[model samples]
Target: YMQKVAVINSLEEDMKALPDEALAAKTSEFRGRLQKGESLDDILPEAFAVVREASRRVLNMRHYDVQLIGGMVLHVGAVAEMQTGEGKTLVATLPAYLNALEGKGVHVVTVNDYLAKRDCEWMGKLYQFLGVSVAVIQEGFSQKRKRAAFNADITYLTANSLGFTFLQDTSTVDRKDDLVRLAITRPFNYAIVDEADSLLIDDCRNPLIISDEPDTGATERFLLAHKVKTERVLRLGHYVIDRKLHRISLTRDGMLRGRPPNINDLWEAAVPMGPYIITALRARELHRRDVNYIVREGEVKIVNTSTGRIMPTSRWTDDLHQAIEAQEYPEVEIKGRTKVSSSITFQTLFKYYSKLSGMTGTAITEEEEFHEVYGLSVTAVPTHKPRRRIDHEPRVFLTENHMLRTLRLLLTKARSQLRPVLIGTASVADSEYAAANLRAWGIQHQMLNARPQYIRREAKIIAQAGVPGLITIATNMAGRGTDIILGGNPKGLAQLALENTVLPAMAAEGLHQQLVSSLPLAQKSWPKFAQLFPRLKAVVDAKLGAHDTSEGPDVKDAGGLLVLVLSMQESERVAKQLRGRAGRQGDPGETFTLVDLNDPLVEAAGLTSGMEAARPFLQSARRYSCLPELSSLTQDAVERTSGM
Candidate 1:
């Protein structure tokens, strides 16, 4: 890899000397070489050099040596475990452009629609400048639009969208127009999965299912089961829950107790009462509101556990969705159960590609899974600069209140230094809990989670999350794709200013609401807006200027973004990802974790029992408290269990 980087660097000056037109012409030139039987490896160095130079010209961002190595790792169809903020996005352009020369399509899979669109628009400029056609596949895209996107040289989409599209195309359609036609027409060529661990490992358990035939009379049974579980069954006395396995079962006493009035009717209708009761119990005990899913406009929406984003089109399978709905809104009309027509897991979906590669900060932990499942090796790419982030010892508290109190003190200290703090909570409910405490403490902060309002303004909130003295509480991995620029992102600030100031004024003047409503559309029509309303440009420019001149240096001096993890995640990878948010591009930062002994992770790992077993020993050793050591042990155990 170093030798290849050297060769690529050797061609950098020559590539730089070429004009924009000539640099872009290299795309066609490479295609001609490939047509003449030259392999991608034969042209790798020049191609990388071309991409590096084009990036410098178009995006004004040059790929560092380490990033070039990361690109090479991807081009060879391996996972490049690059640290966060190490220019993984730019590293992708190299292999994507190189592979697209075959005209066989390159798919860049992101975690969600927001990232798919964001990366397409952001990196599409570089690809387009190099004369490579790029498109993004969104959930609401028409079939024709999807066909066009798939036909593009490079396409960006989520793993769910890709898997579902493949499933939809295989539905034995009678007419061509009725089909997505993606799998039938487009070849499964090279794929680059961003956040590889989340997609490949964390999300592999969830298969993409397309269901159609609705089962009648199931809603009543589900509602009855939910009512029985909530009103009759006690958790400890009537049922037992295995949090790690996500299983719940009724106790002998509960089974011996009288059944619900409609239980016989449900059994006669072919719906087993035991399964319904167990499903209802699981829904009530395991699926938490605002944690596992959210109630938006009176509808239950499943939240993606890995990304902490709402999967708007996703639902629980096998009557699980109806059970949750029944548990949440018993009075409302519950949707009927649907039979699975077709389904595909992410593991099977990615395996369909001819060549697969991925980039993530946390793939090393699951490298064995990658190699075993996908036949891909994990390569750790060095960061451009040394990581200066300080990871403090975990502080364990016996109670949640004590943990919150310590968190408050830490936030106060961060505020005193005018340092930005990112509070990473395990779930939306936890984030809200932190938010309520912050509000009571008179602390101003932004909360980003699966809530409807936060979803729309995510970009803006993450943009200012790193501004000096600003506090942002986000669920798990809320802003995974977008970088929280240390000082404040100037472009993001300007966009925020336009949305806050200019767009409202445009609406007041009776301008087309759609034109001003959508940020991208508004940006496209900005020149006209500037001509008609001169103040709009002034407002945006002022914001850009002020952000450019202020706060960033102070933030750096005070130390970069401080990441405060309220609780340890089930997997150490997620905890590391949260810490990765800070100290980007070698910036100085610190990470501190406060663990509640009663946290679900602790309970799930059976650490609570272990701690109890050592309680007497801990009490005797007054001079040396091992609470922190025990907390670390708990985290290790959780990570081990998660890997299993």
Candidate 2:
């Protein structure tokens, strides 16, 4: 890696010698060489150096030596496990530019539409500066727009969008007009999957299905039971829950209890309501509101457990979604129609790409899975700076309420010091619940979860989370390509200023002037702020703030950013990703895990009996025991017993 960085660096001086106009010519030269059948490897150093220079000029950000190495790894088709805040988005430019020279399309896949648009626009400047055409594909994009995006030199989009697009292209008839409408004319030459582990492994079990018709009969099965309150049915002790597999069934005695008392006549009137009742029971017990899903606008949206984000296009198989919808709102109409015309897992879908590489903060924990499943090797790229985030040992509680109380206390203390706090819950409901408790305590906070239409503001919420004294509640915090800077993001502020304003430079200039006049101190604090204001650089740079420019030290003095894990996720990689939000790029931060016996992780682990056996080694009480060693212990037990 050092040698590669050194080689790339060696060409920096030569690239710097070229004038602004010559830089564009250099890109055409690279393309010409590629047309003549020159390998990308032969021009790797020069191409990377060119991108590095372009980034410095266009975005005013220089690529670190480690970032160059990371880019090289991806270009060679390997997963680079760079730590959080190491600038993965910028690193992609090197490879993205190098490969685009081939005139073949390069797709940069992120976890969501927010990242897709944000990265495309944020990094698009550098690519455009280097003479590469860039386009973004979001979830609701029209076919014409999608075709345009797919034809670009470098396209940015979510993995799900890419998969659906690929499926659409494949299923369409191979004709000229059909090809234009279905798009994806180019072959799957290369793909860089951001947050690889979460997309490739954690979500591999659930296949993406394209259905034509729903099963109307399945909806009728749950009708008899749906009329009766789900809470009442759950009150009976007839169901047995296999928490490990997330499956539930009726106990023999409960089965003998026969049809529910209030709903017995309704059950007899229907054609075998037993299975539907069982399904409803499973939805009530296993699928939780806010955790497994959220009731948004009176509809049930399945939450991706791995990412703690809503899978808008995903629906539960076996009529579970309708069952959940019926349970949530008995009066609301339930639409149940299902015929799966096509389906494929990430494991199967990504195989079509000629080259697959990925980058994430927590890929090493699932290194084996990456290699075995995707044929992608993991390379642990050294961070640009040593990580300084302090991760405290787990604080295990006997019950969830106790943990919530402790969390409230922690937030109160952190806010008093003006430190930013980001609480990462395992699901949408958990985040909302935590936010509610904080609100009850009179603490102000913003929440980032997978709610309907929440994707639009997700980037802004995450970007502002690092402001001093700000407390933000989020789900998973995995595969969110946006970086949480220790201090506030100045560029984001500039972008926000341009959001609602007119496109003309004069209008943007007027808004920028208004913004700077209101916050004159921003100029000194953010050296790049003048870039947003254009020709007003000289006037803005003359004035200085009352205090020092950077907010990093002030945040550090107040304890930097604090990450609170309200619940444990199933994957250690995800937990690591959450903790990674802090101490990024050597920034001072702290993380703590406050878990309880009621958490899905603890319940899934089946560790209560194990806790009893290991009581002598734990901090015990009469009612419950503290498994401070919960993570590794529970993971081991779950793997042994459940093979999950």
Candidate 3:
């Protein structure tokens, strides 16, 4: 890797001396060489050098030595476990550009639509400057647009979107348009899956399904079962719940107890009631609003547990969807009553790719699975600088109130130091809970979650999360694909200022001024808006031109962004991701985990017994100033015993 980096660096000066047009012509030159039977590896150094120079000229960014190593790993079809804040997004451009030289389509798979769009637009500048055609596939795109996008040299899309498109194409028997057929016929040559751990491991249990015809009389059965479970009183021993496996089953006595009172034929009705009753029980016990799913526009939307983003088009299988609907809004009509027509697991879907590579900060833990299942090796790329993040010992609290108290104190201290704070919660409800407490304490903060209102402003909120003395509460959505600079994101702030202040004022001066003047912000600033607009525009432009190095002296002096984990996630990788948010790219930062004894993970992992066993020791150690060591010991014990 070092030798390759040296070779690439040796050619950098020559590439830099080329004019913009000549730099871009290198793409055509590389393609010509490929057509003459030259292998990609033979021209790898020059290709990487060309990309690095193009990036520096177009995006004002250059790839580091480690990032070049990461690109090489991905080009050879392996997983690159690069740490957060190491510019993984920029690293991807290397292999993506090199592979696109062959004219075989390169697909960059993201975890969500927001990232797909963001990466496409942000990196499209560099790719286009190099004369490489880049496009993005998003929801609501027409077939013709999709065909054009798929035909481009490079495309950005979510893994779910790609899988569903493949499923739709496979199920299409009679095509009416050439565009649809062409789009469906495109080959999956090379795929780069971002957030590899979340897609390949955390979400591997659920398969992507396309539903077909609705089941007859299934809605009524679901409603009846939900009514019996909620309205009727039942004994505690009626049903059994396995939290580990997320399964629910009813005993013989529970079956008798769940039946309708007016049903006279016991044996005849009981046979049909078993499935519905069990499904309803599972929905009630396992599924939760604001956690597993959320109600939007009178529909139940499934939330990806790992990423904390709403899966708008995804639905629960079996009768689980109907049961949840019946449980949430019993009076409303139950929709999405359909059966599975075709399905494909992510493992099976990615196997169709001729070359598969991935990048994530937490793939080392799943190294064995990656090699055994996908035949991919995991390589950990060294960071450009030594990591300076300080990880404090985990703190355990016996009560939620005590935990909140400590959190309040920490926030106060962070505010005093003028440090930015990022609080990670386990779910939307937890985020709101933290927000409510922050409000009570009179602390100004931003909240990011799966809620519809927050989803649209996700990019804006995350962009300014690192501003001095600001606190941001987020779920798993902020864990991946986010870069929180130590000071602030100049470009994002400038964009927001333009959109909120400048654009509306400019639009208001036209014939539609009445419509624009009615807005609250525009109305308040309209008196001197014209005179102030120019100054605001100048500032916005100046900020936009400045690069984000995240080296604010005051911010660094305050110890960078402080990450507080309010609860332990199901996967330790997620907790690591949250911690990884701070100390990015060798920045100074600190992270501490405060776990409540009653946290869902605690109960789910069966750690309540262990906590009880160590409770006395923990309390005694707290008085002696040995709490940190004791807490670390307890945490290690739990991790070892639970196999997390």
Candidate 4:
């Protein structure tokens, strides 16, 4: 794949040897070709050639062969499944340029504000070099700045920010006046969604709704979410010794109103009026504070079950978060009103991507889900280097105690070897648990999760993850655009790293001398490629973020990162991400998981193959406990009535 992709990109590089005037003309020629009803596929070679030359001129950055292949996929309305550390930022340029030709605005969707603005500033030079307008949409931008960005040929924005704009567009007091929509009728066009999995899968269940105002009405969803209702909780009994909190139960009155009377009536168990419950939340089901939620601004904030950060955007619907909150403090302030912003689930949002495609190193495992849900297909993009991580089968233990104890042994072995450690956890609580336990073991470490002062803190911690014997506990952080450097490990370990990881940039810079040598004696207008070649060299020279090459104590030298998998995952893709942090680019690293049967998802959904696991958990809960008895019936009624 690398050889083939490289050959193709080389041909594009050849085109840049022409005069500057001729080089600029490629943009017009490509657009003209598109205007003449040429398919993007028909224009692929020339269109890519055009971008290749222009990126050289503008950003002084050249696309690698694989990056170009990923770009080609994007231009053709497909996701490019490139690995992390590959230049996705650059890959986007090929398609962004091609799509912009239609004169319909292109929206480059990022997972967060940091990326949105960063890309616009970093890659915007290339777009501007090609004479295409570019802008980034971040949170809390002034109306004018946002409007200017939207007016550009290409606007970069986060999913939530863009969704907020769509909602704001609808509620604009004047029908003809709005910044988000220049036409006031035009919806957004092509979007290259970064962190596609998080948006398309993880967030799919939560639907998006835009209302003129906040919905103050007490819907069960808001009033009953575990995060929100948890604030008013009064604990009647202490939980199991080690755990801070316990399973939630229903109050007597709640049981009377909520639980179905005939929980065993499988036929009619779904009756809405039953004592059947979601919380079954007795007045005194065991509850804990640090593990579940944290008090912020006198208000209870629900922790993201996966990341252990305060879910500022999430609200308890039907007393779920709130129910959990009520369990925490008897007097946590009530989240009385919720305004439905423009909200859409990942499932629904992806379906709207005029043309849908995405790339992830781990998407193949979720092929069935993608196909079944979105009618999308996954194509394996071969990695430039063979993966060399030492993957051990999940080490399942009977209890959390056993799992932690085994983990200590593993940590001791790695620490002895001076291996750098990166522990991937499932949720915030899990990350915390691992961090707390490691601290107890006299192991100092850093944590990156839902910390409020997000940016500087995260960057500071991640920088040293590549160092030997340095331990860092994180959630899905390393899997996404994160890089771990060698931090100057021992000779033996560094050699293993070189053997495992594929540093294409390092390879490219070596070619730089050849590039200079290859320059024609009678120089043509190869200015763009000349400019880009050096920048490409710089990108390689640039520290891969936290994977710095600094040669000192601040560099935090360590062996390969030892990933402590503290939490269990339901999906293969998730487990892959956790493990993906190690052995990136074929780097030698190790991954191991400590699975405790008591994890909530395992407890709620049960351990089995996807659908089978879900079925048994649901059926057994229905049989043994009294929860979800009425949920089945009510959901049917709602689905039937709403035609959803």
| TM per prediction | 0.92, 0.86, 0.92, 0.70
Residue 108, candidate 1: C-alpha displacement in angstroms: 0.7
- Model 4 Cα lDDT, one tens digit per residue, 1-644: 34545555667746778777777677778788887889777777667777787777767777766677787676656656666556677888888887887777788887667668778887887777677889888788766677778778888887767666655665674465644443223456777877666666666686545534444343343334333224433233311222113344444544433423234431253334221134424322433454445566666665544333454555655445544544444566444445554566657655655766666666665667777887666666556567767776555444567668788888888778667778887655567878889989998777876646543465456656676677788866555656565563233233334323434445656754554576454135446644756653344344333244443233333335567776655455666766777766556667876655465444433332333445455545534222233334332332232211
List the candidate 1 regions with Cα displacement exceeding 4 Å.
Answer: 173-184, 262-271, 511-542, 545-549, 609-644
Q: Residue-wise lDDT of candidate 2 within 157-226, one digit each (tens)?
A: 9988988877667667533344557768778889988888778877776788878765666565566566
Ranking by lDDT: 3, 1, 2, 4
User: What would the per-residue lDDT of candidate 3 be over residues 35-140, giving only the tens digit for each residue?
Assistant: 9999999999999999999999989999999999999999999999999999988999999999999988999999988999989988999999999999999998
Off by over 4 Å in 2: 174-177, 215-218, 227-237, 258-272, 494-550, 607-643
For candidate 1, what is the TM-score? 0.92
Q: TM-score: which is higher, 1 or 4?
A: 1
On residues 115-206, what C-alpha lDDT tens digit does candidate 1 reach at each position?
89989998999999999999999987766788889999999998888887787777746335544454436769999999999888888778
Ranking by TM-score: 1, 3, 2, 4
Query: What is the lDDT for 29 in model 2?
Result: 94
Higher-lDDT candidate of 1 and 2 = 1
CA error at residue 587 for candidate 1, angstroms: 0.1
- Model 3, residue 406: displacement in angstroms? 0.6
RMSD of 1: 3.3
* Cα lDDT computed for each candidate against the true fold: 0.83, 0.77, 0.85, 0.60
List the pairs of residues colliding in candidate 1. Answer: none
